[model samples]
Target: MARSLKNPKKRKNKGSKKGGGASSSSIPSLPTKVWQPGVDKLEEGEELQCDPSAYNSLHAFHIGWPCLSFDILHDQLGLIRTGFPQTVYCIAGTQAEKAPWNYIGVFKLSKISGKRRDLVPKRHDDDGDGDDDMDSESSSDDEEEGGEGESQPPVLQLHKVAHEGGVNRIRAMAQNPHICASWADTGRVQIWDLSADLNALAESEADVSTGGSTLLSRAPLIKFGGHKDEGYALDWSPLVSGRLLSGDCKNCIYLWEPSSSATWNVDPSPFIGHTASVEDLQWSPTEPDVFASCSVDWTIAIWDARRGKSPAAVIKAHKADVNVISWNRLASCMIASGSDDGTFSIHDLRQLQGDSRVAHFEYHKLPITSIEWSPHEPSTLAVSSADNQLTIWDLSLEKDEEEEAEFKAQIKEKVDVPEDLPPQLLFVHQGQKDLKELHWHGQIPGMLMSTAADGFNILMPSNIENTLPSENS
Candidate 1:
């Protein structure tokens, strides 16, 4: 299903191919053209173009400070939500210049509703002007009735809590959204119980009270300064309640077991594998005992919790530092790794001893910052880069000459797509600077949220071919 935008605001692109220009009689007119960010340099008088029709819904908002990381919280809302106007919750960590000025932010975004463009566009040659007019009137009536709140602008409700230092990374427990863990730049990891704050946000229908906005400095549930140095790697096991893994710059990973409701038992002995700093961690979706980690040493290691500290297997994954990784929830054997170089790869764990890599792409010009597989789609994933672009890809898509030719003919008058562009590439989202992290909404199939140096973007692209299962199935 394709979605549409309602009351999309016009935006100027910094550098995009000119859709209108003078041409010789011998040259054909290509009214629209696809522009690659790093590959295409802007010509004089050329400005970037944002096609409003390409979005189903797009909203940009900012907190006071830039957040380097954030997690899309799983809400009490129904697990599968296809209807709109929609609402979402998230928790983010700040990267403030002064450590004392930093705080953790919890946000609730609501009234996200929009009309989607047609999934299969109407033929240009169709003689259906009367039918189109009738359809437009029907759509307008539907929007007026169902989306009246949308016209008032989306609402943002925020709750903040004081932290001792800037958060290097943060993650919420999958089993409990109110319980969160944050790695601070001060070389300490703190666990926070946000049940009270969450309840307050949920009960209030109006703007949150900022009178007590800076939540008083309440001591954390547990504070650990076990690691020799601070690091960015963190994850909570989805299959096991309260299980956690935190890696450090010193090349050691620690496992935390739930000892009680508020306290965790951290083992003194660390899971040592990567010779260099561990950059990221992900627990296996199907196997609670299995997990994966990537490091600056350019290796991806698979570990089994019961087998002591040694990794079960290791694969030399990349040339540069392996910065991030995502384990596919739908396909248990598939895992993806992104590197300090722009390249990212898909590896099949079943073939770890042999040639495990299923595919590799060197598309982004800058280092890959964050990557994750879509919760709803097995073959789909999203990547954020230092180059300031968020890209979505479908691994299942393959190049077809006949189909490409037909598509080119159909939209050649509308867009001049580059022949060299990868067939699997689905969408390119820009406007954010120094994109740090992105996550797909667990309850909403096609929705995405990203945080960067500038702020945050909540978006739903119009053209993704989303497939949902039947209720009976």
Candidate 2:
């Protein structure tokens, strides 16, 4: 559902007695300041406030259980979508309390619309006109009462299939989204065809009652229990329709070669690399046989499917456990890795033997859970951390003294911002608790979806300049 962000009021810090016994009445109220997520330390009673004007659109939804992983499905919706009231399709795996209670969730979110930032300036203050603010509020109230914006709340249609265990990780093939592979905590990998459920949800009059408890548990098209231990790392090759890779806690990686539409040949020999548990895997966007993997051993390895088990090259990536990695499709040479220490780094594959690190960020204070490069923008990427924040960054952004000074001067009267924050930090998203994973919509520019312990959030920040192209262009 669409959420409303209340206007933030200035918080007054009342003065207390000091060595000189200063009177509280003599202290003046401090200037209102903007709260920085990672930089600022909140006081005992302080609370974080969200500014609605900072976002182009924002909506939230919840499934019955917490999803440890989710993938945004490539849909029939036209690519390069620049219009409002967009629709999205996604598939996720649940982390339910009991094994049998868990299920795979296939859902759709629709009618996501909100006021464009350019269409409406800050609504809290109307250029020192109190009457104007009152009029704006009245008009907004009338619109809501007249069954305009709120009449049709963002629709959430979901279907589920019972599974034997909690999902460790899940991914859908880029070439065919209905075909998905899932890693179960029970130490098994299973492939499923979600065409039936996906088609049911796509109908205009989908019977919500036909899903959930009403649907019988369906068997996987193919299930492999070759791994000795359970795993979390899994990915389907973007180049091949059904080719897959799965890695386990024992540092073993198995390759799955598709034999037919519903079956796969699981190679007995496992990939040899990474001494510790493989935490994540990413298929190379440009190469047909190459892929990347990060491990608890603090390393990232590049491998070829046909070149035996040994990695083609391995790079020492982080100080702590490397939790996740993302290969940029727009810039195939660039790869991003996130670590348990909350730091994430970007690397160029062309210069791997030497100091290949291009950019490293330590802004997040907890383990980095997920990271991904934008499919639409080569330089843009998103990172999610256990600190309950999702951050967007642009590698192309750089510090400019003159531009910084001009920007400070413009907002100085309205906002007091810190000077130490990184200039490349484009947007900081908060409110989600225990963020597990995030993915950018492949067809829609700047659209992002995230799954957390509490629920899911779909947001498009207004500050991302020129994300939507003009009609003529």
Candidate 3:
């Protein structure tokens, strides 16, 4: 996927050739500081909850620890189909004695119906506490939730494993979903083998870990010692089975190659570019040997795994620190980035004009934290911000030919534009606290999952699927 810079070959991607959409670049942008959308248009009887059968819905929590890092297994091919139900594992934390106490938890959302006797250990068995206590807890939860039917709260079967220092990030391996790598604030990267624990639960055995108070830390299967500072980013390669990538607070990136040694051996030298901390790293869905990284240095760099010393291409991407970057899941030449300056942008790698942007979105109120293209509909993406807002926007809208031509002429002449808006604004969600992460379910295109300060939310679009972009703009 690393293009020979001289020729700069362009992949015939329909989306890239079509450019952005008909409307402007950024969606309805905010010129003001505060985000207070008026909700008076809502009908009185309308409910935010989706039907039980529908994957689109909203699930939130009022109190608990904040989930900083989590991974949702998007079974694209459903090849991961197993007797075990789909689950979400998150790294969360609460105030502890000396510092923040972090724990990794597994939550089985009841909507993923399956035999659970084997998937969850009976709480009653663990404590030998009477059924009366369980009844009381259920009653209290029911009273607080106070809903029925489509609004009926999901049944959560949770198992947790406590860890020292806060867990900054977690990634579930595509090769084996049960194996996860977690980066901790203690400057340690740990691999937790949930095999015996999760499998026993699926067999109706009392396996209570990864979602419990117990310190179920397994043996040191793998830990990359190169990251001496905060390790906030970790991603397992989807194309290369167990090949893993991690970035640390010390502005270094480390690639782990398993075959080099029986013990996990990482490339001795850090990927020595990015002057600032590497914020995020994502692999090209189509390019197995190539990946991209965003950094606080206000740039996005593409690197070839075979040549680990430097990036193949570096784009001066933003005016501020880039917080996150996502390579379009379905398109080889397209990518998106979020920044600390309350902005996120889309780029077509084929058009390499210096500092020229295809679509620069400066609409959100706070710095964008995470952004991901919908797996089912790559044209749409869900963005979560530090201001506790979640928005889904469609990027495939087309521009009028005449108007687009005039705009191009202005850009060709180096004319400046004051503002940018999105082509199609699909949905905006608020009323949550500390929104940090969001991702769409692989099978259900309209469904979204988000992690917040106090809890997690499963967002379902009421009744809208993405529309494909027209070939011509």
CA-lDDT, candidates in order: 0.79, 0.77, 0.59
Name the better of 1 and 3 by lDDT: 1
Candidate 2 TM-score, C-alpha based: 0.86
Compared with the true structure, what per-residue lDDT tens digits does model 3 show for residues 1-473? 00011110121111111111111212234221222323123345532321221223455541124556677653333422322223433333322232334466654454332211111112565665443442233332222122332244445545556666666677887777777788877788877666664554344433232233354544647766668787566788888777788898787888886673234678778886889888898987877878888888999988997876799888888889888888887875788999988789998877755653578777786788889987766678888787656778878866466876664553442222323335455666665555677776655445667765545666555434434232211
Error of 2 at 194 (Å): 0.8
Candidate 2 least-lDDT 10 residues: 14-23
Model 3 alpha-carbon drift over 4 Å, by segment: 1-55, 61-64, 74-100, 112-148, 201-215, 260-263, 353-356, 398-423, 466-473
Better of 2 and 3 by TM-score: 2
Question: Which structure among the candidates has the greatest lDDT?
Answer: 1
Give me the displacement of residue 192 in model 3, in angstroms: 1.9
- Order of models, best TM-score first: 1, 2, 3
Worst 10 residues of 1 by lDDT: 1-10
Candidates by lDDT, descending order: 1, 2, 3
* Predicted candidate 2 versus true structure: per-residue lDDT over 1-473, tens digit per residue: 00111111111111110011001111135434655555667676655555555665677676667778889999987767756667788888877766777889887877666544433334555376443542243445223222365424467778887877888888998888998999998999999999998897788544343124343488899999999999989999888889899999899999999999889999999997899999899899889899999999999999988899999999999999999999999999999999999999999999987977989998898899999998888999999988878889998989999999976876665567777878889888887766789999887777788877666778777666555563322
Model 1: residues >4 Å from true position, as ranges? 1-30, 122-145, 148-152, 208-212, 469-473
